[model samples]
Target: MANFASTADLEEKKITFEEIAENVYAYTAEGDPNSGVIVGDDGVLVMDAQATPIQAQKLIDCIRGVTDKPIKYVVLSHYHAVRVMGASAYGAEAIIASQLTYDNVVERGQQDFDSEVGRFPRLFDQVETVPGLTWPTITFEKKMSLWMGKREVQLLHLGRSHTKGDIVAWIPDCKVCFAGDMVEYGATPYTGDAYLSDWPTTLDNLMALGAEKMIPGRGEALKTADEVKAGVGGTRDFLSDLFETVKKCVADGKDLTATYKETMDIMRPKYGQWVIFDHCMPFDVTRAYQEASGQEHPQIWTADRDREMWLALERDQSAA
Candidate 1:
């Protein structure tokens, strides 16, 4: 039997603060959820708050290490509990997210919080400090542009990849972008809340921005154009491969358990070394199965549903 995620990920990873562009930083911790920091002329814009308030403080420390600018904006790339809950620690002037993202929080934020903690307990080091669901003080529809003094940061919806509320911040002058969970370099993109059919097109829209440097949701920052293209392509391929496999399973009238096994067998060899492959594949396959089965909107995943699925799929199939 495979070790549960709890057992497999006990030790913490070393966090690195690397500057991908001038005053643009990527806070990556070995394949853990990442946060982006941009120090503009007047203030700072932080993309994706860490999992908890305590986890967020480490980011604050990194921001202070280089620039003393106050964090004026906090961007929510999506409505995931692990990404948005750390807004409090930033003490930013405003929290920004897509209108859909804010709606998602209103609809299923609490359920996601409970479910995610149960899956990756170590990521929420100080879960207690999270002050309930994080809300966006500002929201936009398709696209919105803001200025941190003279620098321009365009927040675009670009259809949907990871989630309905997914947004990516583009720094046109720097030719760098902060892609929330839209892109992953050496990490597996979690798709429990994804739109599988629309994801590839959304990725194309991301590439359309022509960002030479990019910060993936997880994994180290992509420093070159080739590296950036590879990250986007890798994410697109992973999603396509997983969804196609699930679609075939559904066509063959296979059950979720059988489908999951086949998916693991197919994806493991190519993405086995990628971070969170085992933990994410189960959730990814579940969502892909639903999409392939004709569900337009993803079903809300509560803590109870998370466990039921894990036991049904991740546990001993022989017993099942």
Candidate 2:
């Protein structure tokens, strides 16, 4: 029986640094969080820093293998601890994020750190090295355009998907996009902090960008337009299916335990093998139940809340 989420996922995943576009690359490790690398004429831009300095160093080494250019920018897709906590290691000139993300860091960054570290200890290896909440040196309200020499990187918040602060890095030159946790390819979307009703529209905006190739928050790089569309559609389907099921269950006055069972029974066959599906579902359903019953923003998931919810949902799961 699983004791805690992703704690035993200690074995190193096979790392692949693939150049999907001319100067854009993806550093993927099995289904762990991915960081997109854009090597430009003058410097490099890193999207979604790994969980710790130790974790970030691996990507830095990978970057060194290709170019000796300095990393000039570290972009946070959202405020998740696993993605943003490692920003210090890059030693970049600027760390960039949406203003909402910056605000989220101020609000629940510490609680998120505690919650995430407890859930995925393997990813945050050498956790003590994390400097603290990664505050962006540059914060944008809606859109900001950056230049790494001649390459134009557009940071856009089309709408809220995975979280209120979700953003994507769009490179028009290569028609490649670095989609953060907003769109998971084969992996499950952790919508515990998501706006489920608005998520699909947010994904549509991603589609409208017409990115021929894209790197998702997790899973492998999408090398073709077809694969990019697949990622968006897959994420859309997952969110809609989840909300629809949970909404119906809530309207029928089913309790969370029954909701958990029915939703898992429905989702497991398709998404069971995806990374963190079991871990995310309980949280996902809880948030979905809240939203379906009228809560707007998701309630915070602290370490204490995490344990309580786990026991409430999965305490007897091992015996079953």
Candidate 3:
């Protein structure tokens, strides 16, 4: 059977730290989850902490290289364990997240932490360094603004796409946006906890921001408007096509196994080149199938569920 979810993905990715604007930066790897840095006059605000303390410290090193300012706030783009588990390492005054994200942390934080660690062991190096669950010191319903001296960073929850509480940090003056998992450059969207029907409209809200530069959740930074559009458009197209195909299969009364195989045959040709395509497809199609079959919210994924789903979808079908 295919090595269970990312277990074979052990090679370390090369890290890149690039300046997208005057003081705005993107800390990216080949295809690992990315973090965004906004160095204001007084302090720095980080978007998306890495998977563990050791990983987060690497991003901290990148920030220190450019500026000596204190890291005051760490904003969680969503409540995914891979993105929010490293909040403690920043030593920021306050960790911020949307109300929905906070709720998810309360609801499924430990399950997610356990599930992710089991799936992608390489990303959670020094996993013991993670302290319990990362909680938000401050939470907002829709939007809020944080100021570092004169610079204002607007945090807005655009809509439900990747998760119910996915937010983007928009710097109006610089026209730079730190789009979390809501937009990915060339990485496959992990829709295991996504709202597929609402994703396109959410992308519409993100497009209205008109950010000249953007730091996606993964992949390299988009330094120009055209690149930004392509990043957002690429993500939208992937979700659109995936959901559309899955919905058609469901309407045709295909079983989950049949739908999965059919969807893979179609999507693999187009999205196979994207990072994590194989690792994410089983989970992605399962969630899409659930949503298409009338489930409103995504079922929380546990480590047990991860293995069971992989075996059912990716292993030998006759044996399964």
Candidate 4:
């Protein structure tokens, strides 16, 4: 009834390609999913491919303006379709991700692809260009490091937060981190497939990296230590508050619909201005509710589930 999820969000956002460090760049749209670029001596590595090959080409165009190096690697921070489906467009030598991420792809990749496309139609502009699931050519367990000539890019799966397989790409030389959905600046996190209880601790681990600059999953790149701290802190606060509120509602033996209402009443005033706040709340609260009720792993979100959940929690709300 509320136009479903992000279906009414049709306005295009202005894209920004800014260099946050010497060779590290952030490709961000106003509040859409952001991508990271690291230009190395011999080649380049891209973090978090956009939703489709056409969307990926826009990022490639921006990269071409800065360097002519071959896009040698594509790194997926997690298994979300929005972050990995466009990987084929890079034509990279290898696509890297955590082993858990690969497992997720094998398990529910198609369901997620269908689910996300239905939610955010604008982001998946050319969905037809995506070639099935984007499987990783290389998978790591905990951490791995790649030497881009003289620069060292370390990929670390700090902990489970945004998703079980979320990883951050750290550039030791520049102290810059490409933190995929694990951290967000002025954007409400989409935690439909998250481990809400483990998220805060993961944020703590992410902060311990001491990154002076960070490129978050969505929103602007954090260019200073203070900005980085704020971004991480903001994300932590949102997740903690939402999860805790949901936990309390569950402890009181409230139903999912009532729990959703109570959580919204508490969170909206504080996080109302964040991008996608409205769209994310229903899914975020539902997942939090499940976790608080003792569900360990997130259930896969198919298109039908998305609609059912929306109808249950958000049918009475104004259209997006």
Residue 133 Cα positional deviation in candidate 2, in Å, after optimal superposition:
1.3
Candidate 4 stretches greater than 4 Å from native: 316-320
Off by over 4 Å in 3: 316-320
For residues 25-141, what per-residue lDDT tens digits would candidate 1 score against the true structure?
Answer: 999999888999888898999999988998899899999999998899999999998888889988889999999999999999999999888777787877988878898999999
**If both were scored by lDDT, which would come out higher, candidate 1 or candidate 2?**
2
Q: lDDT value for candidate 3?
A: 0.92
lDDT (Cα, tens digit) per residue for candidate 2, span 225-269:
999999988888889889999999999999888898899999999
Q: Which ranges in model 1 have alpha carbons more than 4 Å from their true place?
A: 1-7, 316-320
Give the Å shift of residue 85 in candidate 4. Answer: 1.0
Put down candidate 3 lDDT per residue, 162-249, tens digits, no spaces: 9999999999999999999999988999999999999899999999988999999989999999999999999999998899999999
- Each candidate's number of clashing pairs is 0, 0, 0, 0
lDDT of each: 0.90, 0.91, 0.92, 0.92
Q: After superposition, how far is residue 160 of candidate 3 from its true place, in Å?
A: 0.5
Give candidate 4's TM-score. Answer: 0.98
